[model samples]
Target chain A: MEENTTTEKIFPPGSVGLVKSQDFHFAPGEVLELDCGRTLRDVTIRFETYGTLNADKSNVILVEHALTGDAHLAGYHTAADKKPGWWEEMVGPGKPFDTNKFFIICSNILGGCSGTTGPGSPDPDTGKPYHMDFPVITISDMVRAQKHLIDHLGIKKLLAVAGGSMGGMLAIQWPISYPDVVESCLAIATSSKISPQSIAFNWIGREAIMSDPTWNNGDYTEQPQKGLSIARMLAHVTYLSDQSMSRKFGRKLQTAEDYSFKFDMDFSVESYLNHQGTRFVERFDANSYLYITRAIDYFDVSDSADGDEHKVFEKVKCPFLVVSFSSDWLFPPYQAKELTRLLLENGNDVTYCDIKSHYGHDAFLLEYETLGKLVDNFLDNIYKEKEGK
Target chain B: MKIAHNPSDSEPILSRSDLVMIADMIPENAKVLDLGCGSGRLLRVLKARKNARIMGVELDQEKLIQCMERGVPVIQADLNEPLSLFADASYDYVILSRTLQAVKRPDLILQEMLRIGGKGIISIMNFGQLDARMQMLKGHMPVTKRLPLKWYDTPNIHPGMLSDFRDMCREKGIKILKELPVSQHRDFLRFLAPVCPNLFASNAIFVISK
Candidate 1:
């Protein structure tokens, strides 16, 4: 584990070099109390920071990652790495996030297989991987653990909390959970509660992962690669829209003269999905997928406030920018509109934009130019308002 | 009577006399909501001159971006839908300028405006004006300066006369606090608009409250 003090000196002041991820471990006495009536001891958070923290620490911007994302939010870890961070287009020296002016921090969420504490983490009591023994965590629990990381960094308030999809869920939860610490929230392709259809899709993915013969009831020595791959294939379909699928691969053969009519992957779309599934299983854990999906399924902001969503959102002191893609069927525009209505009813400043896109739920990540400009303007306005105050 | 020509190069697209009249009625430092705020021109002017805290509701994507570019906070929403997001009497003024006829339910929108605001300012082009009535006599729909487009291309789905709106307000128990007639004609016709606004006024602006 690299210490914070040492990592801070790795990059010279005013340079825009790629920052490396570091592990921050809290002692057993500093356990994170979970909503499931269980506690996670010696919690470790893997986070990466971009840009420099200003003198007052008011320029901090916390970027939350989605269900399958890690702490590598921007820049390549090494020059040899083929790919940059997951959201590299939106966060750089002169990008919409503008690392030149603001400090950016992204951490792997709790119950995540990344460098965070999750099912893959060792159970201190048993001296083995927690696996199924890990307590079910909620989005609020993930946020609470992130609060610890932010406090460790000595940031009093974040200029903005932003994310898309599952990341957007955390963005919404941040202001509700820590109203005084977040100045503004930008929630994209997310909702206050998961729809029944979304829950059904997630259930199907979990079933695929658990039904594999090699699962060994969550105690297997070897990872459940087959089941995890199938589950990922199921999810990869939902991330793309029918229009996008057809436009990219419409009944085209996958390097074949004619269809073989067998169970083989003949169509280009099927081949693409298989490739995605194969690549995903290499980087993600099956047990972590089950736990994180469960956390998302159980998320409902109203549940924490006596079943009143208005009461839950009444605690939000910051303005919000709720964005949704036109073709995102999974987390559609109406869901975002409903959330915006609730926020407005509570007398909070909320702006909503149903961006026209055919990129489905992943539009926020794919359509960076439009999303980037809107977010840039929104953040610039917020910064100006704060300066005036 | 001298008719006003197309706006000169010096003026903005929103420099219509009716919009200017509406902007004049708004006080300084007020909390204002501009419904169907196309490109946020009125709200921008209000923010600059009155120092008002303004929010806008616009449905068009391009206009919404324009509003954002001008640093005006706007929600992308159709005016035909209910403004249930806003609390009752939350805004000092709610201005629906030149968009009443285009809505599906103008009466409900007016009620919602008065419900969510202390005062509601609505400006509508009168379909029962002299030119419209004369066109009706000639078996043609009017396409005057206020109602510039042809019937097929116009967005005014529910073209209403000034008297019709007054009657609707009366039936709904809404008090008309003030009324201003906007006319293109400079002298005699402009003077006659106040006397018989339903027949002579090209457009009308009404301030109402519940």
Candidate 2:
């Protein structure tokens, strides 16, 4: 449990490399007691907030970050300074999630690399880093922790909750777990559950980590560089678009005019993969990545909650806006359409948009003009109805 | 939550300007039917401004409830479905708001609306606006605050403008009593929308007598 932080610092000062992004300073609260019947006793959570919490606490917008996300949603750190959060496009002044208007909160997830009570955090019972000893967490457990946070905030009902990709999964799950506490929901570039194809990719990534000798069956006090790097490489493949690779590489050479390639980063794509993997391992904990990926692998909200795939749609009793990018093969537009169709059939006010983008799964993060307008308009529609009152 | 504005004081309930011209076309104190009367805003104006006995048709239960809450009589009905339940010539004037673009068949609904009432009033979004034309040339469907949807996501089956609406009306053989186009926010374009209104207007409100 007590593995040292890092050696040969790859992240520049204030770089916000995969983990240890405390620059924004989302204070860690008490260890959350688990209801999962697992050995994980208590969990510490890092979280941040922006704007003033309204008197009635109705303007709270809970932002659930993605798989590789930290609590930093937007704004700079006042003290040990860092750049703004990943979603600077949508959370600033006059932006979609304008902090001036609503109370915005983001929390590092339970199994996340950022300062949450995850695999990297020391296990008090064993006096060591939790490592493999940390109990397996479900997406539902993450929602339960969020519920506790809301209770702590003394907020009865949230004005709205929004996110994209894995974060989007959490947004949809919130209404399911705590149906009464939400007024509106915005899910972007995500599905209600993980697809089989996604599960296969995640499983292969996990295999890559386990195959490396440095893993040492998850007991290595030292960094699992080989395993973690390989795992990152595999996961990186899923993130990039086919077209992006085609344009970037197109079967192109890396070093020389022709292939002198003998077990080196010969192809341009190979070099890109190596760069992504090495940089990822520099700040990320291998064990934590594994745990978080497993959580994603197991996340299928339609199961148990709704026995039938279509039934999941009818059960969601809220005004929702589901957005998906045409280029996002990770969670295609059809799933969002399915949710819309079922909601429409079940007499729920559901709005859907399939924006045309060539950016793939990362569109939610990169495509601002499209994602920003969709979010701004959605929040605007709800805000306008609240305006006269 | 704000006090419902006076109909005659120049604020139209649905927050559109062409409504003023369309409201003026409505016969005074005659039986009036308003289709897709969202929140009963325009019908309340008709009631207060012209002393018109109003019946509103809405698809969304929430909007229908809003109409009822406003003390306006409303019936929940879909435009694609039949509206022959009402007796023949039961209304002197039937009004259809900005819902023409969203319906399955604008032609069929208009015929029923005109058949039930001695005269019909139809106000639709005029897609022939110069801005939409500009959008067409840009290769990508230009999204604006007014028609804020991409080509892939718009709920409207057929979004038409001033000229297309009038041509369809003429083909249906419905006598045009008044054709008013509104482009500006409210008062500015209401007076100026006749010749060349088809180019600049956002909506065309037509009052047709059988």
Candidate 3:
């Protein structure tokens, strides 16, 4: 928990307070199947719930996290904590997710470094870290694990599923995985599949870690700080747009009156990227990063449906709100439009909005005012439609 | 469908007569696709009045937000692109109001409308009207109530006459199921609009089928 202190300070405080993360474990014989033709024994999921579940258990909203996000969605675990959850602006009492109105559930994915079962988790047989032994997982497998958690909580169906980036991928996979259970989906800044360019970036990140001498074949006693920092630095560049970088840092010197004439982080942008990388290495596990990025690389919803994206959406009965940002080159607006087109072709009720933001891929996380209103209006409409029925 | 009765003399925010006539053509519970639906006003009205399952396709980013704010299901897309996203004859009606003349290819859009919708309702501004003809006779482009811009600043790239649309529809084997001529004229002029729509009607709404 202390590892995330630096990253936590970047976000604002939440309206809700005193929330705690809870762990749910399955017995040894209970197996969770993996996409790589393997089985995970004795799975455990660490999740946080905000707001009370109604008697009918119908007010549940499952929030999926991105690659680096965890289950701490809105409130601080303690008053001493420096910052609130990652989506603090979106899940409080009066926020878009609205803890007062809907029950919010966010969980660390199966292949995560958080308090969930991942490469960092101990193997039951050997009583050691799973590391590379952890079976490769898919987006659908992640949704299935969430479904198990939901069923254990006695919730029949979820009111909505939402997330951005990798979380957004889960949001898309939820309805496809459990078509009958999700009433609505809000997917932002996500794609139906990982593009080759993104996969190439992920591969480079993995290479940076594996090529590090300290990595020691995924069983390093000490953290692979150098390799992990490089990976994170590369990722941070992708998360931001050229415009955002120009506006925020703009080749300004980092407190140096003159050019350093050396490669020692002279530029403000370089210093900022180094800071991001250093903080990320402190919180995230290197092996977990490799496994999760590999999982994302394998994610293709259309491939599961024999290359017909329209067929994949034909089973979806819920309303969808697909959002993209104007400057998000990582997962561009065209990808969101493709998903929307497939959904529309299947006659599913879908709304697509391309928000005009210079925040790039991170816009979904930062542009809460506009994104919150869109989600609020969409959810309100769904509620009204249900009431009218 | 939910018409607001304004007692004041202020001009209506929406085109009341056009929307009213279009709403009259749509049946209850029908699936409707509205192209270039600005602010989703017509779709909202249709949802309230006709109980239609309406969707809008708008290109402008700001208007798309407005549509979402009103809880209208809208996709931000250019109507100039092909409507291949929809299955053929999926919608009961596809309405293109005050948008055909501004599109890159109105004929292709109409064909798509008839392919994706069982019926197509198009509202067009008649450039061959008497006011436009009078302006042309005076050696200038028209700036009437329908075409409300100077020649160079107009968004209407292909300002077409009523007869031109009819001939195109006839050539494409699309049957004109119903024609409604709209005018803001006195008794005698209003009476003559139906007889010679291309010469008299300032605006026209046509319901067609393949």
- Clashes by residue pair, model 2: A1-A128, A1-A129, A2-A129, B126-B161, B127-B160, B127-B161
**Cα displacement (Å) at residue A192, model 3:** 1.1
Worst 10 residues of 1 chain A by lDDT: A6-15
Which should have the higher DockQ, number 2 or number 3? 3
List ranges where model 3 is wrong by over 4 Å: A1-14, B1-15, B145-147, B170-175, B185-188
DockQ of each: 0.53, 0.05, 0.61
Chain A: TM-score in each model: 0.95, 0.87, 0.95
Please list the residue runs of candidate 2 whose C-alpha ends up more than 4 Å from where it truly belongs after superposition.
A1-36, A78-82, A249-252, A304-306, A309-316, A387-389, B1-210
Candidate 1 per-residue lDDT, tens place, A119-200, comes to 9899989989999999999999999999999998888899999999999999999999999999999999999999998899
| Candidate 3 docking DockQ | 0.61
lDDT of 3 by residue, B1-210 (tens): 445545572522345577767877888999999999999988987887788999999988778878877778998788889866677988999999988999999899999999989999998988898878889999998987666789898989889999999999999889999889987643237668988988888789999999
Task: Sum up the clashes in candidate 1.
Answer: 0
lDDT of 3 at A287: 93
Chain B TM per candidate, please?
A: 0.88, 0.86, 0.90
Between candidates 1 and 2, name the one with more favorable DockQ: 1
Rate residue A385 of model 1 by lDDT.
80
Alpha-carbon deviation at A278 in model 3, angstroms: 0.5
